[model samples]
Target: MVNRVPNEWLLYCRAGFEPDLTAEITARAHELDEPGQVVAAESNSGFVRWQSRDSRPANGIHRGLPLMSLVFARQSLVAFEPLSLSRDDRISPVVELIKESGWNFESIWHETPDTNEGKSLSRLAKSLSRPLESALKRGGGLRRKAGGRRLHLFWLAGDAVQIGMSFPGNRSEHPGGVLRLRHPADAPSRSTLKLEEAWHTFVPKEAWESRLHEGMQAVDLGAAPGGWTYQLVRRGMFVYAIDNGPMAPGLMATGQVEHLREDGFVWEPPYRLDWLVCDIVDKPMRVIDMVERWLIKRWCREAIFNLKLPMKKRWEEVQRCLTRLEVTLKAEGIEADIACRHLYHDREEVTVHVRLKGER
Candidate 1:
């Protein structure tokens, strides 16, 4: 069993979403009966520090707040108090702290916040990472094995850091919870990265071959300029691109896409399709309603869509939409695996993926 730590929690998010993420985490903690106070939440900080009132191992906050279940937080870990390190001997103090914890880590990641200031610490992180690893190895605090805990060293400044650890299978695999993907040179637009990131974030890598294979039929709503359609074509799937706007000439030339000049919200697929993707810039509720109809009627086996959130109450709106969608689907006897994430490539929106259960 994974060891449960104390009350402190560290959550990372987008640069400008500190408030929203704090609110969401606070509300969630209350709902889980682990009410806590925010220790630090600066505007555009790209991170939040919260501590629960009850620090008991049995009632630890992380027990209720699995990182994956959270919408606003990109990464979450059990954190200790921030350390003020000596400029000349940063590695010794950090290494000593790990030794004092009496815990072994499978791997260590030197991370920073996702902001301009945070980016500036990259060089320092790189400079210290090698020596830190060497020290941990010499001290026997580092062990590479299955199911071992992962260590995190969060650099807040050149001489300040927050040390944490996360259980395997309970935290993001990427450092800082950001997956930096290269934009395809031939893609229609940057929006293509959103869909690509969605697939990587939501789908298990081992299941990709069967779930997202060649010759599958897909529909791309609001596919103007074919950004999303390009992904489908590249995957060897036939696409019905729904939009009155023009498509990319190169994409259309692939002979795999059929562009339909029609309003996406009004158009219906002639038959059930393998995939349904939408990037319509519409109200969150409207997008949710449309996606509901498609799933309720079994129009598609799976779906990936975006919900353009309002300026205010972004987290609340996301919860309402997700709750309504799940409740509606359950009421209709439809079982599905639903997931949503504020991906690296997404802004002002969240990507959602829904896959019907017990379907091949």
Candidate 2:
């Protein structure tokens, strides 16, 4: 029978995205599903939280809900799925564990030719079995009927996988469609370890590179070693590399980058900037404050930054921050497009991209 799971983990990061931050990711896996037994989670870092209904105790410790609560309480489920594991060298143990589980294997969704070879079908099955069982156990006619179909695998990133018991109405891997990188030059290779791979999955290379206009100005806060700045410079945009430390020679040598050796919070741009980018290791509140200053003050025309989340109350805090920011911006008569995504390349942090309306 087929089972369905979450497409993304929405990794709960504590003030930054870290590849090793598996606990928050695990919590998110359980957080995504309704009636699933967490069969087994990868024991090492706890990134992979697998759930099934086949009499196995869901592995690892769930954060808030007790076992009884899941069984007895009317928990409002928002589509839970197990996290997927990815690394430079090792095969994800979750892949193996899912095979060990009794759930039948199925196809994958949104998988690309380059990555399709590495896809693990059985592993995804175990992670989704519990959720499927729940739908059947609940006697939801459509959901149960859907469960009878073959399973489908859709990898969201290293932190999450989307398991579908039925085929998607449309076969597109990116159901939301593609987000091309604003600049192709910004596409860092697999060797570029500093940037996460998932970012590329979310932001396509052709789109982004083509979108970058020649004279756009941008600022990179805390741009030491300049991994992100490298993307900007390659776009042929003038960038203010704001940080106290030295940027990589390659990024600096581009001449498109201007070193700004001042505190990100205290520094002011000489004029309005096209974009404000920050990847500082600080409290989410601080990042919010930085974004607020830019938005409320009209310091930049657009922005892309990261908000490092704290454990335990990540969703609440993100809501609070986003709500407050939206209110603040509205109060200031600013209109902008804002989005938060757990990019494939991001660890512990969520990326924010905001563009003010009516800006050319």
Top candidate on lDDT is 1
For every candidate, C-alpha RMSD to the true structure in Å: 2.8, 11.4
Model 2 Cα lDDT, one tens digit per residue, 76-130: 1112354454554122333433443434433322321112322343454455555
In model 2, the runs with Cα more than 4 Å from the true position are: 1-211
- Evaluated at residue 319, the lDDT of candidate 1 is 92
Error of 1 at 296 (Å): 0.8
Best by TM-score: 1
TM-score of each: 0.95, 0.54
Report the lDDT tens digits of candidate 1 across residue range 175-287: 89988888999999999999999998888899889988999999999999988999989999999999999999999999999999999998999999999999999999899
Q: How much is the lDDT of residue 136 in candidate 2? A: 33
Q: Residue 223 of candidate 1: its Cα lDDT? A: 99
Error of 1 at 195 (Å): 0.5
